[model samples]
Target chain A: MNQQETGAGEIKISARDVQVHYGDNHALVDVSVDISDKMVTAFIGPSGCGKSTFLRCLNRMNDTIDGCRVEGDIRLDGEDIYAPEVDPVHLRARVGMVFQKPNPFPKSIYDNVAYGPRIHGLAKNRSELDEIVEKSLRRGAIWDEVKDRLDAPGTSLSGGQQQRLCIARAIATSPEVLLMDEPCSALDPIATAQIEELIDELRRQFCVIMVTHSMQQAARVSQRTAFFHLGQLVEYGETGQIFTNPSDPRTESYITGRIG
Target chain B: MLWLTFLIIVAAAALAYVLNLRAARRLWAEGARLHSITTFHALYALFLAALPAFVFVVLWLALSGPVIGALVLSGLPDEVRAGATAAQENLLLSEIRSLARGQAFGEPEPWKAAAAARLTALEATEGWARLALVSLIAAAGLIYARTRVSASFRARQRVERIINGLMVFCSLVAIFTTIGIVASLFVESMRFFARVPFFEFLFGTNWEPQIPIREDQVAGAGAFGWLPVLLGTMVITVVALVVALPIGLFSAIYLNEFASPRLRAVAKPVLEILAGVPTVVYGFFAVLVVAPALRQAGQALGVDVSPNTALAAGGTMGIMLIPFISSFTDDALSAVPRSLRDGSLALGATRGETVAKVLFPAAIPGIVGGVLLAVSRAIGETMIVVMAAGLIARMTINPLDSVTTVTVQIVTLLIGDTAFDNPKTLAAFALGMMLFLVTLGVNIVALRVVRKYRELYD
Candidate 1:
């Protein structure tokens, strides 16, 4: 697959010259990428290469940081995110994020999944909220394991399970796009493999944009891969082409693990 | 003088050791080091020669100055020697020595003048003897140190061990001081308990310590029930918590979860400014502002107005305690992993929902600990109550009515002249013991909750 062919896929989120600055640091330079609907897009780069910064841009998470400024345009399915009338809070409901570490709320497993649906008034009552919780947990691929322990604290789960639970929580509101910032980095090898498989499966329903350090994970899970270095998007193409053959030597060097 | 000499010797020894080590390393690295003994041995010789010389001089100065003066006084006539105590001898010898050096001693008596001449000679002889002894002892120590020196000696390791021991001694001093305090409080409390029944004092309902002044009046008939004071303390603490908890927790939530960095920077210090204001100032505010406002409000509400109401004092105290709870809650809420909030927000939950449902619950243990600490501060508070609350120990539960706390009562009992044997003063100790025990219990529970939460989270 080539860049032109991948660009033609069903668009979920489109960014045009998205730039991010943190104080004096130019974190994300002029970058443009279109994330596909019901497909996974992976951002791969070296440490401090602004892959996570770009991911945060999708959900306006960078707004939380002081001295962070985002320029240019990011649109969710043709809706302008940076518009003066846009509410970041409401925008975050449609575009959710999962962090690198498994940070389960100190609440019970049921409450953790029910939290999103309850807050958005997605469920009518307690029983409706209960059903949403069960469905989300099941979709996250951990309901069978934690079904009997729904009342237990979310933090009581193992790392892999907690990550899955976080995924469950993220999907509870049935968000249109999911942003994961190195969700598997803090996990063990087996957990990373599990999450990679889950990401591939999640692509059937939601658009997934993953920022990862692992090239192998990008190659295995994402349909499209964007290579970043020094805060610039260097190359973006079909995952196979980005892994097997590339237009740039820098991309080749990064894919072959000769240099970050 | 001895301490100063010891300090100087230690400083010199440390300096010699560093220089010797560096010189040894250089020579050894150069591959032609030529010394029969190790480098440390040279340092040891310098240290031994200097330290003992300094210490011996200090010791001789401390001893001989008094000895020669006493000898000169003993040789005087009995009548003259009658006034020759140690201090007088020292003054007389110093005076006579100055006179012998052609200085005037006012109008010197013939016997004193004669004694002064003899004392000057004795001082010179004694000084030489003292010097000889010091030099002999110093030489012996240096010889012993030299004999102990060898090529393979581990002087640095020995010195390191001695330093490590000194560090441990310094650390233990703090622990011993705490133990000493506990022991003293325990003894004093025991002395109080011997006079009053422990159970009655613990579960008392009254507290009046007016002692009889005249012989015709009854000697000891004051009630010492402490329940009213305890109740007053509890009521005030409850009122303070009611004022503090909601404001403190919400502000913490706002700061931790919602506030932008610029807003946080501006707001945090503004909130902490409450903490920097002295409790005495808070007391003044409670008395001058809050108490009057409360009294007027009570009257408007058609309730009986008490000028020194617990509501006013406790309300101001709680405001003073807001920073404590808010800062602690902020830390606790902030400590909740970002992953949790992100997870909830990603699920399309609003920030408020994420905080209310996830962050707040997760931070419960820490928040509770903070609240507990604040409660302890409220219970042990003295100034605000002293200024705003009345001195009457009424066993009423009305908020509009005046009440006195344990701390205020203790202050009133022991502030003026009173015999230690009187129960009026002894009751203060008993009250102090109770207050200490209660606060200590709260701290222990708070620590336990915090530890349990940490273990669960980690």
Candidate 2:
């Protein structure tokens, strides 16, 4: 629950005094946080609390939005992402993002998974590309259901399947970190539980940072949880400690269902 | 002319109002509330008086004012009775009214003076008639409303039915108009095919329609092998598409995907200005500037060129078509969901890559629709080709050579002095029917393609 920069492990992403403003409204204040390598960190807050904004900051997805200004420095493994030498295209390849809504490209499932790898030249031959596609789909854990009809449109699948396909597409390029923005908000309870379990399995390979409104989801899936409110990081600690034992008033209220 | 319908509506509305009033009052009386006459009885009396009273006054003002003046002009004393004949009385009244306005009547000085004197009296009578009409309607409406004061009325239901009827009438107008257009086109085209041999018109290679002037001489047999004209139309239309499709679609891509918001705001209106320009001006530009330029360019390239080459006409027509392609392309591109773009970008695809691979493929149906519509426009284009491309019947594919299109041939055939009874004049209708069918075919295909795209995405 305090400003502690613990550099005990190799940090994958580091932020220093990051501030974001959308038009005249300040979205993120003078704040700083660091993400450790190969771990799942969950962001929980009320709607419009800027948890999604901070998550998008990792890969510079905020660049797509007009009037959005990022003032502070963000670095991916020690390189300044905002510097003149950095190419956004190259940077996004290193860090991939999934949206709150499961948006699959209007193409076959095979094409959807292959789109990123093809553009980045990750595979040398068609056979290599095929292998990579199958591997990505297997890792994302929807291969058995979709393996029979790879030519079917990705949108034809159920919502849970589509979300998993998007995850597979994002990881096809072998990015170092994966960003998930409310990935379960559009899914049913069964789909949500499936995704929560998948997130747990995914943490063993990639550095995962997710934004969720469900406090129980954070407790069940994340090793560490960060609480955000009104564009400020109010608390960050072990999930069990934050949920049951000690935290700021806002974090306690939000966890106990008293306030958001 | 349909004024009687309004009277029927009014009667029905009055009946509804009365029923509501009676029902409401009955409920109130059950609760021991004292009331005036039941609403139905009051409304009934009001309508009985108001309908006749208002109609009576209106008829009086409309009919009697002029009649009275005409009676006075008949040169009888004021004590004389009015005539039984409506027409004679009306004539007399008009003359008297004219005289009162300080105009002299036809050739009798004493009679003109007498007519003018009576006209003044007729004006007062007309004014009274109008007053009586207004008072009668007002009194009737007031009395009917007063009767409802003591009872509830269902005004809402009556108004709703009238509104629903109006809605139905408006909807039918749209449906009937569509039916009318198709029927007319079908019948006219049928008449044209009957006069000319359908097989000869469709398959013949030559199209020279000249007929005889006098009965003693042999008539020039109208030759209409449509192959040349159809070929010419296809050639020019192809050239136009080649010129327009690239420039228009590229500009559309640039505007939609690359341009800043401020730049787009300016460029869109400027590009749309091409649509507002009259085709006649484009025709002149094709003839005066573009034709000469194409001839020079062709000569420089070591090729023989005609002054009215298909390339010149097609190129200018394509310029005219720029707005058509760009606007539709802009719509097609914009119609692709933003979420699709987001999905692509999040996976690290570059803008150019995303647009080429994902956006353009998704918008293919809409873009094809726009191109087909542009093809129809190019085929039907007359002014530019008439001025820039020559009127020859040669079937050639070379863009530098002078060519004639179906529309240009049609214009030339129908304009010069020609006998209407001969096959020469009627040939225009045959050509028109062909042009209509081509465009109709294109529209149907375009609509089907667009519909298929809609089903895929939605």
- Looking at model 1 chain A, which ten-residue stretch has the lowest summed lDDT? A1-10
| Strongest candidate by DockQ | 2
How big a share of the true inter-chain contacts is recovered in candidate 1? 0.68
Interface RMSD (Cα, Å) for model 1: 2.2
lDDT of 2 by residue, A1-260 (tens): 22222332467888888899999999998767887767788999998888999998888888988899998988888999999888888888889888889988878899999999999999999999999999999988899989999998888899999999999999898998899999999999999998888888777778889999998898899878888899998888778888898559888888778876
**Backbone clashes in each candidate structure, one number apiece?**
2, 5
Candidate 2 per-residue lDDT over residues B292-407, each given as its tens digit: 99878888999899989889889999999999999999999999888788778878888898899789878888898999899999989888888887887777888888888889
The C-alpha local distance difference test score for the whole of candidate 2 amounts to 0.80
Off by over 4 Å in 1: A1-8, B1-164, B213-220
What are the lDDT scores of the predictions, listed in order?
Answer: 0.81, 0.80
lDDT of 2 at A46: 90
**TM-score for all models, in order of appearance:** 0.79, 0.78
Docking class of 1: acceptable
The segments of candidate 2 whose C-alpha lies over 4 angstroms from its true place after superposition are A1-9, B1-182, B185-188, B213-220, B418-421
lDDT of 1 by residue, B1-458 (tens): 34544554555555555555555555556675344335555566555656567757767788876777677777778986685577876777777778777788478888778877887787677666665655565556556655554445565564456457668978899999978877777777788788778887877777777765345666558888899998999889988999999999989889877887889999999999999999899999998999888878877898887888889988999999999999999998888777666666556566777787777877888898999999999999998898888898989877778999999998998887677776778788878888988999999998999889877765
Model 2 chain B: lowest-lDDT 10 consecutive positions: B1-10
